[model samples]
Target: MQEAFSQTKNASAVKNNYDRVAWFYDPLSRIVFRNAQIQAQQALIPYIPEHANILIAGGGTGGILEAIADQYPAGLRITYVEISEKMIRKAEKRFTGKNTVTFVHSAIEDYAAKSHFDVVITAFLFDNFTQEKADRIFQKLDKLLQPDGKWLFTDFHIDKKSSRSWKTWLLKSMYLFFKFFSEVEASQLPDTTSLFKKAGYHAIFTAFWYRKFIHSSIYQKP
Candidate 1:
């Protein structure tokens, strides 16, 4: 499961760094990003279907499932996958009473599912990978989705041409600083729309927050 990431430059180092800093993740994340995730989540809510069987990859603290369970019906089944052991533990604690969500302490490539999912949601995870890895991830995602299923993703994007130049620079600077501590790469956010199209998924809907600081795109299989 980890071998692909291990061989990929900086992946293992980033995971190890996240493990070391797991305890302070949420607070630091909120502080540094300034509620960017909350804004993304708010923007993502309308994308979810009421009866969807969802697959969530890199669901660090599992808060998205909470948001889903809050807004969606009780029948929705969610499988949350995360690679960090510490993050998994924290998620377990946070989601203790939620019987509708299943937790997998493994990478998306490692987890085996009984059926293809109706919806795939990845929040804040795509920006951490290299382009090669991003390509592989989308390839794997193509195999996992059901026919006509939806793929929804929200993550950071470099907003150089946006009106708020200083804000974009600040976000980029913080991304680099966190990369040094987390060993994760801050650059190489491919317009996933291209990769998903190449993987045979059609663009269904797309939205961006603050021009690119946080962006969401949804694709569907024909």
Candidate 2:
């Protein structure tokens, strides 16, 4: 309790913003993106081994937890990390599966002494941090991954082919809304694909959603 509180007290505005919107976060996603969010998430489920040590960062409202539990009834050790206390509470209630899951209400950057895992999942997580913070978080999580582990990443992407598309404007508008309400750090999406590649990770699989604005990808260090 002390540890969680200490981390929370030192967190950025994103924590408070998520706490305020924890109730509507899940519903709002469904209303705007319908099943697309879940669909994109589900795309990476097959990549997880039946029995594996997994770390899911920024696992908002337990959507991914619910999905993983439905697929793996046992032999799964998961550490779920999130910054929002209210969001953590919501995730705790929604997780009813038999898998061994630990919910930690701390920013991924603050969580320490983690075991290396077979899989690391970060969905809709990278979109919240600026370049420098994103670098720190990525390096932190990257170190927590096993040499041969799979990195499951799902986030908004920007492609030159669609640089001028409606999704671009939509992305801008969403940032503005989140900045005002959540005060998230990043003003725009980062080129995460390049971020991974530059670190020597290889993209094993990738699937797109919401007209290619969103992507779910599996990467590995080969």
Candidate 3:
């Protein structure tokens, strides 16, 4: 989750940024969010049907691969999409199960779908983008999902009602760190809940972790 990225036009910079931090991304995340990121992801895994086709976009360090593989030791295929070569290599060695996985080394924007996916997992992906980039990415992925497909989205959530709170300061500090470290474009998290609702994806389940700072939700394409 600590991996930073940018829009496609600046893919090289983002790739370099992610690669530079690939060694420390997971450790930094654990230091900051502890197990919240992991918990939020696992909360949505039960919704994935057996033999499902899954796409993991921006899969940092590929830690979740082990979890998904554990959930379905067989009868599952994963398309792991990432921009960083170093991260891809790390992810390649992370999976230790029977599920078939195909690693795609490309930005999500540059990723061409060979087949529609039954499940799309974009954990902590959107928080790195501005509203425009996030919307563009969302629209693209929205089209690649099969009907009745499940979209698992997990990211930081900040309440607009509370303009001045610890979460706001913490998020601001995080953005500053990411901006300095990875040239990330986002200064704040997007309004993800509204974005999903606008896309007409029906929410199947929602959960929060790390004191509600992190949100995980599964939506179905009707």
Candidate 4:
């Protein structure tokens, strides 16, 4: 409890820390999480609907968006929401001359769009928040989605039944390493399904890669 409060107290430092390192985030992330990204891409492939309006939250570097663009049918629309100016700049440069998408330079929690999205995808985003913050975000996301919309999410997961003591230690170590460079919460566990359920969505499909190294989950908003 004390430790968590200590970290939370330094939240501003965390935000500034990420802002400073956003420029180098993509390359470093790719090196450490390459296979996980590929798994997330594959899991998302089957969920793309023809001529649908899609929402991408915290879409850094736009790799997932580019992949979706290649597979999305013509006439499909995309809204890419990102918080970091550095990441937005990089995405703009990557997608130069392409007009198939709209970029929103704001956090998802602050974004208010009149149109309900057919699909809302979040890649490597929710892990940055504490449990309370995550709950608030999911509630907001529920309001953003259409009745028949689906939410797609991918993130790190702890290996199941792999010696709790060791896993706990390993989890702490990993969080420290990641937190040094990025804004990530150690308590942010694999929550794609729970977040969806609490937000009134029904889990439709899920995929696990490399023995819980990563998880991709799809939930339908019924």
User: How does model 4 score by TM-score?
Assistant: 0.80
Q: Could you give candidate 1's per-residue lDDT for residues 1-222 as a string of tens digits?
A: 011121123333434235656788889878867677766765666777766778888888766766665666466777777777667667766532343677776666556666789888888777777777777777787778888888878887664475367666666676686577666654546567678766677776667665456777777777
List model 2 lDDT by residue over 1-222, tens digit each.
Answer: 011223455444543247767789888998989889888998898889878999988888888878887787678888888888778877777654678877877878878745788999999999988888888888898889998899999998878887688988888888888877777878887667777988899888989999887899999965
lDDT (Cα atoms) of all candidates against the true structure: 0.68, 0.81, 0.83, 0.67
> Considering lDDT, which of the candidate structures 2 and 4 is the better prediction for this target?
2
Q: List per-candidate RMSD values in Å.
A: 5.0, 2.6, 4.0, 7.4
In terms of lDDT, the best-performing candidate is: 3
Q: Give per-residue CA lDDT, model 4, range 92-124, as digits (tens).
A: 665322326777766677777758899888877
Candidate 4: C-alpha lDDT: 0.67
Model 4: clashing residue pairs?
A: none
Ten contiguous residues minimizing lDDT sum, candidate 1: 1-10
**Is 1 or 3 the stronger prediction by TM-score?**
3
Segments in model 3 whose C-alpha atoms lie over 4 Å from true places: 1-11, 15-17
The candidate with the higher lDDT, 1 or 3, is: 3
